[model samples]
Target: MSPDRANPPETSLTREFLAALTTFGAMGYVVVVNPQILSVTGADRHALIVITALAAIVGSLFMGFIGRLPIALAPAMGTNTVFAMAVAGSGVSYGTALVMVLVGGIVFTLFSASRLREQVVMAFPEAIRTGLQCGLGLFIAKLGLMGGGLLTRDGHFGDLREPSVMLAGAALLATPVLLALRVPAALLLSIVAVTLIGLLVPGAHGDALTHLPAAPVQMPPWPSDYTFAFDFGSFMNHLALALPLAGYFFLGDFFSATATLIGVTRRAGLMNADGKLPNARAAYLADGLASMVGSCIGSPTIAAYVESATGVETGGRTGLTAILVAILFTFAMFFWPLIAAVPAQATTPALVMVGVMMMEGIRHLDCSKLENTVSAVLIMLLTVTTGNLVIGLAAGSFAYTLMALALRIRVAPVLLLTDLLLAVYVALSALTLHH
Candidate 1:
């Protein structure tokens, strides 16, 4: 092959920088939103802000330099909510939750380094994977609607008379239009626009867009109370509880990262003939390691952000895009006050839109098949209604396996084993709840 064939022309630095900037804009909302979700576990808000940014910085740097991939990593939205809910429901301290994350990260790292991870990914039939993605999308959208004040606690729509609710409604309507127009950083722009509207309009309840900080700029606070604050005693004392939580975290993180890698790489035309991502090991290792680092810094599981596709779509072809994102995140640490000033109403639209985008996976599923349609619908409904990704996934997997067996369809041994394991896990979880 000619040298030109062997080595593609280098991407323009201008394009790379712009792509990186766009990716950051698309994902930067995480810096504020993660802290908001996780703070419900009684974590210090300022500390969460710092830790969220720090985790993103660490994960993005590792993904860029070590993995040589254009993916950005951050404290994942779904898993962070899971962590907070687990802590609240189990009466566990935030430190104990961090310990669970640590344990999950270790297990994930081991899986990533071995062929086990690959096997697990392959075990899930394509239809099942699509179902999981769709379920998660709806789950995220539910959370967004709740956060935006558009939905009431009783699952009814909030009062349209409320200015905050009106702002959220506007954002919800505008975001899709912006996206449809192929606007760059459309989600981020929607957030800013909604926030600006909130600042200008006083709510019926006297709720302003956000409480402005005394200082527009200030040094980010150190997360001294949270850093390395794992509660080993609690973790060990509640081994049964901790084990399941860790397992759930591991499963969620692994599958989310795997799906993102597959989707992003395929879109970028970076997949090999065997349909495997180039440098897959490096990317997986980086993701797993980032989770561990995030745990140490008092954040939930960190994983590859699907928004990295924005950069790829903008011509990001190398590690440079990721590095730039890391650098931007590092700088973002100094702007904690401004980031924190963003209202939930502003960020909710992005989450909803992202959820909508994730649901696109469902289009690839064979909806004509009864088993496929039922399983997918069940997974989506259970995940949203139950408010637990693990339980939803387990129930769906078990249902799929049983249906396939009844129909005499060939099932992979690995998938069958997964189904059995999940059945046991669900039973144990029920026992725990009963006690």
Candidate 2:
């Protein structure tokens, strides 16, 4: 009998909306990044958008209705890039990459359903977890810079500000303001506010508004494009590349999702004594399904966004917020132009600010601890330098594990398992690079 068991249930509508909004944050990534992936793959952009949207809608519905969690499903950003630019880039068909994605998702789902997930969680030290979260912030902040054209490589690391300063400042200001005022739809609202400001003010480029190319990307109603084609022969040769990616992306996605959920639940005042929620499994399952379906639709795995914490902070204690988000996403498809009209400049600030905001999670971490500090520093350096989440985690985990072993530190079984998996990822990545 837990305190959560003793409490009254949240309202159904509220629950639905939270679930939908959570899903909406998950959906935003696809709208922002999938177009780029499609271009890299030689796939039709319009087909990809329609198919990806359909995939997100269907997958999100399944997670919302079937899984009964606040988790939203979508193509994951990290995995899709790896698939399109790295794995498939080496001659693997987009269809084949889709199959591998499915395979990875299946593996992740299995881990979630079984006790394996518990074991992995037990393996990492708290310091490592804190470091990873902080690293994710840096990782995302860098993305904002690249996305907003603030860090373009004119030479090295590029100029820190062009239009970036303005956009970043707006997002930075808006995020805190929205948080302080306790606004509903704070994530969406912040972006909208910044975009509005961008539109009203003369931008550095001197354009009040920028329009994305309008193309009606339609998916065939038939299932003709659904190919389960995988080159097993190529897979073996490329297993070195695929395995690390599979492990790294899976760990990063799941770890971030789990950490965010716990943080959000607590922030929403919905946590029990053990820090568990009623529909925790539902939320976790949604992440896996999002990744699985996103692959089929030519998108990356979409995980729970840290920014959605804003919704939770605003008293979104039910799933209704998530449901609202899903509905909004459905409508946004029709008004893709409006979404497109939001200049990258306007969006970058929020992302950069979000990167900064998430660093707060590290406060609970004792950086003074030797093992913790090593892992944290390693993760931060790798993240900033490589600009790769998976790489940073692998590097940090390896250092953490090696230090633990050298010091003969007795870590939890979960942490030990985490270290082992991270070791496997590091090894695989090394082999791939050597090959």
Candidate 3:
């Protein structure tokens, strides 16, 4: 391609702002859905709404000013579930979970800025990479079902007679149609639509499905409410347990952010002839720093969002597009009351749809490589059956390593180390479970 074809023209300020608006319309659902997902961990929903918005705001600003890319960022879906379900639900406090996230972010930042980033990327095994994404997707979908009360704690179907469960069911069916129609902010709209139904429509109980909140509008929360709120002491006292969780956060953030940045930049024709992203370290650094900031502010990983591709496709070619996105997120922080009022049933649709999308990565698995394919398939099956990300990951890693050795495939030295670490982690976890 010619030079002009390789890079799109610079966008005018008005166009950049419009692109930003479009980008937010595509992903702004996270402003509400994130808190709903994370709130299960016993964190304050109101505080989380503000923190989620703040994470997006800070993340976008970093991408704009430092990375100089149009992509936006926010709390990632998979790692959030890992933090909420696998870590906090397994007896770890939310405060200590945040500390784990912070530590992971720091490590990711250090690696992202050095040659380690390239080396690490090269070390990824295709089967494991594909497996992680698909398995994580299944886990997220499971959470959505249970969180919406559509499923019982034992994974049995809940009473469909409940009005809230019915509404959630309806939302699950409606979200895809909205997405098909290319509706702006389709996920957010689905959430709000279901919430409104739960508010106004009555069922056999002679009442609306969901209870009313104390109010509909309130002042946004201050950063002081969550700044430095993590339990560093707990994390320090439990390094063996905490380190594994931190490793998940680190690996998940690294893969998701790098993949998103590559896809978005390539779509925008910003990749060089060598297929290298310009200012790669800067972009990775911004992503890592945002995750650390997100943890401090009561959120999980904040990384580059794939939804920002809407901005890129809409002719956003400059950092100004991302800056505009930051300003919009800042405005969203004020609607905490309304966002907090959105029930898990309403947001469950988004979780399901996102899970479905994540599962699309399964196609990347090469069936011709039977040994490699087994790893990905096993990961997804184990993850769904066990309802634990760590268990699925550890077992799948060991299985993959064994398969590679048996097939006479050369496994990367890093993967061998990973297998050893996973073995240690599983042993520690078994001890904890028995105790």
Best by TM-score: 3
What tens-digit string does per-residue lDDT give for candidate 2 at 1-435?
546547744655655565455546533645544554444577655455555566567655655565444444455444455555543335566665666676667777777677677567656677777776777677666666666666663424534444545565556566767656755545556666666766565556666645444652322333346434445566556654555556556766777667767766776677766766556666667667777766655555566655446555444555455555566667657655455566666666556655676688788788677878888878878866765555676777777777888888876765555556656656766776799
Model 3 ranges off by over 4 Å:
1-8, 203-206, 210-215, 223-225
RMSD of each: 2.9, 5.0, 2.6
Clashing pairs in 3: none
Error of 3 at 346 (Å): 0.9
| CA lDDT, every model vs. true structure | 0.82, 0.61, 0.82
lDDT of candidate 3 at residue 351, scale 0 to 100: 87
Each prediction's TM-score versus the true structure: 0.90, 0.74, 0.93
Question: Which scores higher on lDDT, 1 or 2?
Answer: 1
Error of 3 at 3 (Å): 9.3
**Tens digits of per-residue lDDT for model 1, 60-103:** 89898877777899998678877887786567788888998999
Instruction: Give the residue spans of candidate 2 off by over 4 A.
Output: 1-30, 33-56, 70-100, 154-183, 193-209, 212-234, 264-276, 279-283, 305-321, 411-435
